[model samples]
Target: MEENIDIEQLRIPEALTGPEAADFLRVVEISRLVRMHTWGNDELAYTAGELLAQCHDPYEWNVMLIARVNGVIEGCAGIAMPLDDNTELAHVTLDVLPQAEGRGMGRKLLEAAEQFVRGENRKSVLVETNHAASALAAAANEAEQIHPTSGTGYLPLSSREARFAFSAGYELERVERFSSCAIPLDEALIAQNMEATHAPHRSKYRVHQWLDACPDRWAGDIARLEQCLDRGQSPGHGDWDIAKLREAEEFSALTGRRTIVTAAECVADDALIGFTSISILNHRQDVAFQDETFVELEHKGKGVGLRIKEANMTKVMREFPEVRTIYTWNAPGNSQLLEVNAQLGFISAGITAQWRKDFNAY
Candidate 1:
């Protein structure tokens, strides 16, 4: 028999200074491990300070809830709502230890988070679960081992999260492919590619590199590209109030991050037509997350996308010696960017499904 657990919100100052700090971090560690094991994603081991920062953010509202049974932490949930646009939308994320499943601990944590959102008058909720290809493959192997069916062959991918979300009344909205590559990328191969693809257009455009901040001259140009990305990935049926983006935000000082950006400039007009960037947190120097990569409509078909990526990869290898892996996401329909990633040596890691639910429906 499993014991019922109580869910409590982990507040900032109290969680940091009080006697429960260590326990809070322990819960986070277990949740992180469960995510990695179940989703086949990167180990995003976050620190207490980072967690506190989210709680104190001015532009976003966040809450972290921990579930405990007899004073032992078993699971946790994260709730967030953007302060600006999409005011009615709240995002929820929950993770439970593998051995703790079937205990209803996850459901309890989620109910608390959803209740918190209702208190804030948020009418809609969004959540995402990453499905790794490795996990699916492993499940297929086990299904075959147990017994083989007819032409159906293997069992469809199933997860505790999907079932839980469906049971709680969430609908699948979209699915994005996850890809990654071990860094210190094969320089010889990329160099050869650069020569064959980007060399012919050398006189037309030039590549520029920066760390943490974009130059003053390119601010406006970069802002436009950022907007392009916002519109490019938006779903037709998605609901939203406003889109606030700026170049200053990207260059703003961050405590424990080093941003590396590579952009392509058209020589004729010296305009920043495209860019790609990766950020490495101080505590996780070995892992870099691909933030965004964009090329303006006018610059399309000239290989600007590949050029910036290749240039940035070269700089990261030389500048960030600790970087070992880079992870990225792409909608399967975006074949162009996917091809560029594949050419740069990224392999499919898994699938990421976006889920949403309207409070009115319930």
Candidate 2:
């Protein structure tokens, strides 16, 4: 007979030193190790503070469940549902320690996640799987390659993540490329992009910079731009308003992160045409993440994207000279943005596929 596997919901504590800190730390370690084992690196690992802030975020409802066997934690599952919008969707992350695999731990954790979302009355569930570039290329020609509906990227059917998601009744919706660029970027590249951004069409737009908080005059416009970006990806989901924007800013501060933003405004109308943001983790000064880049439909193709990205990059490199690398993700079909990234010296790091299970369809 097997020892009983107990599943319990975690109560996110107010601080890391609280009574539940030990258990929370265990979950964090297990989650970090699982990702490191899978990706062969800790490039995307999260600090405990970062994870805790995510759980405490006011804009989302976050629940974490841990699986224990004989008082030892073996795995965990986290489900996050956006409260402001997309309330019908639950994003789930399941992680099981390598040594604990093949013992039905993953299955149990996933089942718990499904049950929780069902109780919340969510209609859709989303999960992501990561694949290294080398592994993907090795299996590119295999007959079992799974292509997303977008028809632009492929994942190996032989991969464990693909097999697991498929068995769990999830469909491949889209794929994104994770790329990284070393800091102290080449002077020539920066100079060239800057020169190109000075074209007549782009000259009409001026760039604005901020360190942490958005200026009062631009807050409303920033919220609108965020909404536009959200809707551009998921038609009904970009409901960003001023309140949510402030909430996100507060969340960033709570995570001990420095938010740097650069926005482009049309001189003729004084309206924000595009914007880009980069975040630097206070705990890890050598690394940064490119959060988001958005341009109005009419302002694209005129260097708005590149201008804002470069402006933010220049500011970050100057203010934080210790930064070494910046990471970003983009859909394979986003040719324009990909081109801009390539010009900025970003190289492919890995690929991640988005999978979804629609309960309402059943």
Q: Best candidate, TM-score-wise?
A: 2
Look at candidate 2 and tell me the lDDT of residue 203: 69
> How much does candidate 2 score in TM-score?
0.92
- Residue 255 in model 1: lDDT: 43
Local error of candidate 2 at residue 132 (angstroms):
1.6
lDDT of 1 by residue, 229-325 (tens): 6687542212221222232344235446688899988999878888999887766678888878888888887888988887887788889988888
* Cα-based lDDT at residue 10, candidate 2: 88
* lDDT of candidate 2 over 79-169, digit per residue (tens): 9998877889999988899888878888888888988999999989999888888778778789987889763887888998899898889
TM-score (C-alpha, index-matched) for candidate 1: 0.86
Candidate 2 backbone clash number: 0
The C-alpha RMSD in Å for every predicted model, in order, reads 5.3, 2.2
Worst 10 residues of 1 by lDDT: 146-155
